[model samples]
Target: MVIGPRQDRRPTMNDVAARAQVGLRTVSRYVNGMTNINPEMAERIRSAIEELGYRRNLAAASIRPGQTSGVIGLVIGDLANPYWAALARSVESVAAETGLLLTIASSEEDGARHDWVVERLLQQQVDMIIDVAPRTVGRSWSHWSPPLPPVVFVDRPGDLAGADTVLADNRGGTRDAVAALLAGGARRIAFVGDDRALHTMDERYEGYLLAHAQHGVVVDPTLVFETSHSSGQAVDLVARLLREGRADALFAANNRAAVGALLAFRTVGTRLPIIGFDDFEAAPLFDPPLSVVAQDVEAMGRAAVRAGLDRLQGDDGPARVQVLPTTLQLRGSERP
Candidate 1:
């Protein structure tokens, strides 16, 4: 009878040891890259490993002291969003430089899905996690407890006390955008933004208020609208505001909302001064190129990766909230 190892079974170190006619410890040392093996024995083990298609199990190897699976995980609100996509690419680039693999998942802005995706990443034994947390629905970070790897938050802060965070100066950016519109003689400025529950949006809204306060302009509450993270909804809301001549200028607090506002303005043929936060792919190609408060997404991504790596390296320092500056891009749309 010519029986052999199961075809479906992956070859293991034991199989390599048997095929090499060596002790299991010898095979272990060879696989783990330890030195001091006989040249002939090393040759036999190498040949056996190649012949059997044997691969080191990284998950198992990570259990040892000073070892890692060499994988990092990123959780973001939506990968389809250009801002998040850019951030992911930046993180991927940095990770590639260090020979670390990155695994990314989108939460779709659902709090439950966010928790589920995080749990799955944890199961994969990632060395660390970088997250751009989703807006929760009636839930706070204080309520949930899941064993987590070293985590660095990007774009938004999480409820975990002392968790490292990298973010843009949301308030300063929006304040500057509003100030620009006011400088261009825009009164009755309208503010459109994502969910009020989101910290990022809230900060932008605060900036809108602060700018008006500083400039001695009273903000009309009727001109501000907070909607779901939907461009279509933003279009509808903005279209109504424009048609009714309720707002002479608009400040869209996100890329998606800005797109919606653009479409609405085009349909109504209203060339109202507009400033958007988070520049998008087509922002510069509009009839009058869109002006924006551009966040340093690449820097945010790089900083998040560095923070996670620092935590992994046992920095154990005080948690940091690094806020990168945002720049106002005056691309003609802000001119009144």
Candidate 2:
């Protein structure tokens, strides 16, 4: 039998102590932020820690009584989306204010992945969790029993009971977009969106119908398309609709679908009226600037963090939902 060094092992505190020529207690004190050590000794320990690349185990430290992990876990759907990215930035800003570390995970709207990420966050003993629930996973929190840490839902609310939720006004935003198109003299407006199973998509679709009804304009079922939230799929769907000349204007329910529709129109050298939900980068730079229904993403993020903090502070009140408003930003794209 041959014996070799353990290549997988991380450098331990004992290694740091030996390198610093200090007692183990001195190393422990330095790692724990104790101020009783001499300056010279502290310098030696710091140098040793740097040289050995020592990292304190936050999970182990949090296990001690009265010690908190000071970490918040955030789970979002599709970090690639600009809306989700902005929301994350807001959450990070608030977490910084509280001096808590934030760990972010992308579930990609997959139920299994969302569950797995939540379990991992719990294992790390995070102070709380902020999540944008997966489209298919309703009531995900029911799987876990009592003593669960505080959780706040953002963007989309799942069936998690007694948890606070923060969401944009999806239905009203879409309705406003449709109404604007109508006022601009668009008689045949097309609606493109993600799967209807998602709460956001369903709400937006409802708003589309309501806007048409209010204006005494009947919607054409053929002009409305629902796909798997893919930009390429959206491009293909919108291209078919354009080829058929079915719509005088378009309402894209989300950012990705909007980009797809834009590409489809650009491909055919046609500039039909368009309005989209969720503003993204360079939206104003198009040939005709894209109009959008803009949500206060940063405010939503801040509100989520505040709600989580409140729960941590022993506010056992009934669950609350915060529905923030959206605004229409017109830059000539809504005009026919």
Candidate 3:
């Protein structure tokens, strides 16, 4: 309907319901992305929203004062990243058991974007935040000050001043994999993937150094390469390293990086011993399978939720760090 000469109030759910000729519940369900609403009813709600120019009361949905609000927010670097997706599902499952609502936002791996998402969640009066922010791209938890939500850092290295963090056993895991490669008579191993700014990267690289040091081997700096974000980049970088004779064996920082290296080796008809940080779904199905240090993602998820809840329950001092153990999945990739 067109606006008349008279002043009009902002459109509410009631107005939309009236114009759509549907019950308030029907409109509410449609607006919330719930599946119960029939197609006909959803269309009617859509038309009414257009006619009445109704806007959602986001501010009202936020800020329920002086109580245990059931809402929690998650800020992830990328929704497309499988690791993040798995962790997100686990967090939601655990939170649901306690009747808390879980909402997620993606930062597209940008620090500024993550900051905006965090602020929005804060406005929504969420009890806590779980973030997958890396130390790279200038992300630091210290930037968040005053009335901050209890925050949990997962997988990525945090700002490091003091924040609750859950990470894998990087040094031990990497050291074992490198030892296996050496035992198989493979030398000239190269480390690939991830920028130097991330604590995860530092830990993995330190593991590489430790393994060689323990064996009285020296690292060739030229063999280390930082590649793209996903496994595809891993494949390309590994291919180049092999082509240039960088190393006879490779240590991939994560699953994606390992997958890339495997693909690259296959393309060049080379079967080098390879190891990765995280294991993939089709790891065992690879031509030579794939060996990896696997973190218990579900356990990590549960721990993050527990940490967040503990903070929400009024333990707001300096943050704590939690490290979880990782298991080695021995596959053909790390074998001769």
TM-score against native, each model: 0.93, 0.84, 0.78
Candidate 3 regions exceeding 4 Å error are: 1-62, 138-145, 160-162, 316-318
lDDT of 1 by residue, 1-336 (tens): 322346899889988888888999999999889889998999999998988889999988876656788998999878888988999999998999889999999989888888887777877778888987787742555554655578888888887776899999999999999999998898799999887789899999999999999899999998888883788998899889888988899999999889999899888888688999998778899989999999988888889999998888889888999999999999999976
Better of 1 and 3 by TM-score: 1
Shift of residue 124 alpha carbon in model 3, Å? 1.7
lDDT of 2 at 228: 36
- Can you write out model 3's per-residue Cα lDDT over 1-336, one digit (the tens) per residue? 543222457888888888888999888778767987888988888988987778777557445455445777888767677777888888999999999899899988777888788878877878778887733454455666656777788877566454588877887888888877877777799888688677777788888889888888888898787654777888788877778876888888877788777778888887678888886587889877888888788899999999888877777678777888888888777875
Please give the range of 10 consecutive residues that has the lowest summed lDDT in model 3. 1-10
Q: For candidate 2, what is the TM-score? A: 0.84
Q: List clashing residue pairs in candidate 2.
A: 139-159
Each candidate: how many clashes?
0, 1, 1
Question: Which portions of model 2 miss their true places by more than 4 Å?
Answer: 1-56, 64-66
